[model samples]
Target: MMIDFMTLRADFPLLQQKNRGKPLVYLDSGATNQKPQSVIDAMNQYYISDNANIHRGVYELSERATYQYEKVRHDIKEFINAAHTEEIIFTAGTTAGINLVAQSYGRSKLKVLDEIIVSAMEHHSNIVPWQLLAEQVGANLRVVPITDNGEMDLEAYEKLFTARTKIVAIAHASNALGTINPLKQMIQIAHAHNVPVLVDGAQAFPHMPVDVQDLDCDFYTFSSHKAYGPTGVGVLYGKQKLLEKMPPYQGGGDMIESVTFARTTYSKLPFKFEAGTPNISGVIGFGAAIRYLQQVGMQNIAVHEAELLAYATQQLVTIPGLKIIGTAAEKVGVISFVLDGVHPHDIGTILDDHGIAVRAGHHCAMPVMERFNVPATVRASFGLYNTHADIDALVSGLKDVLRLFK
Candidate 1:
């Protein structure tokens, strides 16, 4: 069944608002998606009915809240096809998830002189965490270069792998360039060297169907906000075996099996990593977001996004002074481009006047922009709710900008 975007758009209440006296055309789902009413209502219902601290209270509300919270873990486990619900750890966001791995897995497993590999197209969230870990542990950080076309240089990545490579951390999709990396092949290569690979799936998770078991990645991180869930909630999916071996990320109330001054033992699997009060309502909302995606179907979403990307690419190419940044064969629904003689900020402001929203800046992938030798580009990212008319509006907005600047 074909999903009607007009009907789908109605689910997101914010989409109905007017921007600058015109209907808003939101194209910035790459940064964070707009929430659906179902997700919002789910969160509100949790706060109203099941408001209590989880895993601690003995009351009925606490038990129900705990059940709902853990149910979201099961939902996430199924959403990513994780081997076990215990393998899913909820953190603040992708940033926190990566940091948890870096501090727990990287610090405990990595020795001095061990190497970690990352790609040139990684967001700062993926890069900085490893860098901090490397600096702290006296380890080395190796970078995989990218080609001129914004795709990861597979040959360069192969050359960087060595016996000392303990971990390979890279983004499944580049947030700045929108290039989908060859993650399956990359995982195969990493496993050949007996190294674990961590994928930052922040951008890819929203647009594609992800199976952690199929990919066989050691760890995968994604933000709920980017996937139409609430902020302050994200998921980290790790292989069960590796997660058992890793130490606790943070020491707090829930992560303890026994607590004493002489001997304090940590809990098993995911609970060890997730300490302190979690985002209970946000996780409930995340489940609703996943349900929303399931109802729409990921394959259907991917097709619609691909069509929008192709149409947007074609329309932008027709303009005289516009250039799309990433021209990779495999891409998501993002189109990053530079307009001649106009800064990306200027283009964004002018487009905002037309109620056409787009992101303008480095997109937290400064190394990518540096590699391309440009400061930043205007990024128009599509979501499941976006339609061909949104692309037309964006194209028309860009044309006006070009005419005004020319």
Candidate 2:
């Protein structure tokens, strides 16, 4: 089915607003997506009608609230093609999820001199948790370096595993570069060496369809905000067997099945990981976001975004002194570039004057900037709602930047 991109753009209320007296051209979806009206209505409906805590109350309202919450969990299981609903663990966001695995599973299994493997392209969320874990347990971190084009070196990645390698944490797609890593092949290589892999899917989740069962990854995480849902909520999908063995990352509230002074028995698979009050409205709204994406279809989004990326790249590179970064073979709707004699921050400020919103920084992946020998790059990332006209505006705004700096 061909999606009407303009019709879908109207679904996002924020996109309709003017910025600096011009139409808002949003290109920073790699940071956070603009929520659709359905997501906003879903959250509002929860607060207006069903505003009770889940799992503890036995009354009618509480049961209704619990049903709305758990229904999203089930929807997420189907959305990602996970084997079981129990495998889905809710968290604050992708950062919290990585820290949970690093503390719960990494602390339990890793020993002194053990090794953790990660790529240089990882977000700080994926890198720092292991760094702290290694510092605590005397484990060492081995890095898989990227090539000049910002793609991971598969040969170097496979060679990093050895007798002491316990876990491999990497990104499914680079937020800074928009390069989609070969996750299935990477997972198979790690499994062959008796190592488990964790995938940071924050960037990939919004752009493509992911199947945890197909990839056979041990753990996968992504944020709801990046997928046109509410903020302050995300999901961590773990294998049932692995999660069953790992201890809870935090303790309190509904995570306990039974607790006494003498002995405390924790709850089952997912609940064991989720503690305290959650972002109830966010999860419910994420369900609506998932439904919206489903109606539009992921493959259709992919095709549309691919065209936008190509058009943006083709237009951006034609400008004199503008060099596109991360020219990988496979990429999503992200283009990072640098201009001669101009700072990225300056470029971003000038573009914003024309109502274009692009990110200007290392994008939470400083190592990527270091690898490219730049302090930062101007990144224009696309979403399903974006169009070729948005790219045209971006190019025009960039030309304005060049004229000002010249």
Candidate 3:
């Protein structure tokens, strides 16, 4: 089916606005996606009518609110193709989800001199939690190196496994480099070594469909904001067996069967992990966003972004003294590039004057920057609502940057 790109673009209210007297050319979707009208309405509708605390009150309003909230959990389970709804645990965001696994699973499983495997392209969310876990448990980290084209070295990745390898924490796709790692193969390899794997799916969720069952990853996580949903919400999918073995990450109301002066019993699989009042409105809005993506179709979105990535790369390389970073064979619509004799910050500033938004910094993946031996690069990431015209504006802006610097 041919998608009406312009019609879909109109759904995003932010895209209709102007910036600095020029039409907004948003290319920084890797940071966060602009919400569509439907998602906004979903949240507003909850606030307007069904405003009540969930799961404790027997009142009609509270029941309605609680139903809306729990319904999203099932929606997310279907969205990611998990085996059971009990495996899906909502957290603050991807960072919180990863840290929850690290504290609850990693701390309990790992021992002294144990190793956690990660790649060089990991975002700090994936890196820091493991680092803290290792430090706390007298463990070490084994990093799988990346090639010049930004693909993970599979041979080295296989070699990283040892008897003491506790867990493998990796990214489904690199947020800074746009490299789609061989996640299935990596998971298989980790499983062969009897080590569980956790995938940080923040970048992959926006561009592609993720099946946690197909991947067989022990834990998978991503933030809602990156997938055009509201902030303060994220998902962590764990196997029922693993979740049952691990203890709760936090203690509070709703996560317990009963509390007393003596020992207290915890709630069931998912609720045991999710303590305290949750992000009620954000979770409801996330359900709306998931419905929107399903309506559009994940394959359709992937093909559209591939076209943008190809065209943007073709146009960008034609520019003089410009070099693109992260040329992995498999990538989403993310392009990080550097120009001769110009700092990334200067490029970003010039583009901003033209009302073009792009990320220009280490992008919270300092190891990726260090691996490439560059301070930073200007990154223009794409989304489903982006157009060829946005890429054209970015190319024109870059030409202006070169002219001013030279």
Error of 3 at 304 (Å): 0.5
Summarize candidate 2's per-residue lDDT along 1-406 as a digit string, tens digits: 9888878999999999998989999999999999999999999999999999999898999999999999999999999999999999999899999999999999999999999999999989999999999999999999999999989999999889899999999999999998999999999999999999999999999899899999999999999999999999999999999999998999999899999999999999789988997889989999999999999999999889998898888898899999988988999888999999999999999999999999999999998999999999999999999998899999999999989989
lDDT of prediction 3: 0.95
> Residue-wise lDDT of candidate 1 within 350-404, one digit each (tens)?
9999998899999998998999889999999999999889999998898899888
The weakest ten consecutive residues by lDDT in model 1 span: 1-10
TM-score of 2: 0.99
Give the residue spans of candidate 1 off by over 4 A. Answer: none
> What tens-digit string does per-residue lDDT give for candidate 3 at 1-406?
7787768999999998888888999999999989999999999999999989998999999999999999999999998999999999999899999999999999899999999999999999999999999999999999999999999999999998999999999999998999999999999999999999999999998789889999999999999999999999999999999999998999998899999989999999899998999999999999999999999989899999999999999999999999999999999989999999999999999999999999999999999999999999999999999999999999999999988988
Clashing pairs in 2: none
Task: Name the better of 1 and 3 by lDDT.
Answer: 3
Off by over 4 Å in 3: none
Residue pairs in clash, model 3: none
Error of 1 at 212 (Å): 0.7
- Model 2 residue 12 distance off true place after TM-score fit, in angstroms: 0.3
- What are the lDDT figures for the candidates, one per model? 0.93, 0.94, 0.95
Instruction: Name the lDDT value of residue 207 in candidate 2.
Output: 92
Error of 1 at 87 (Å): 0.6
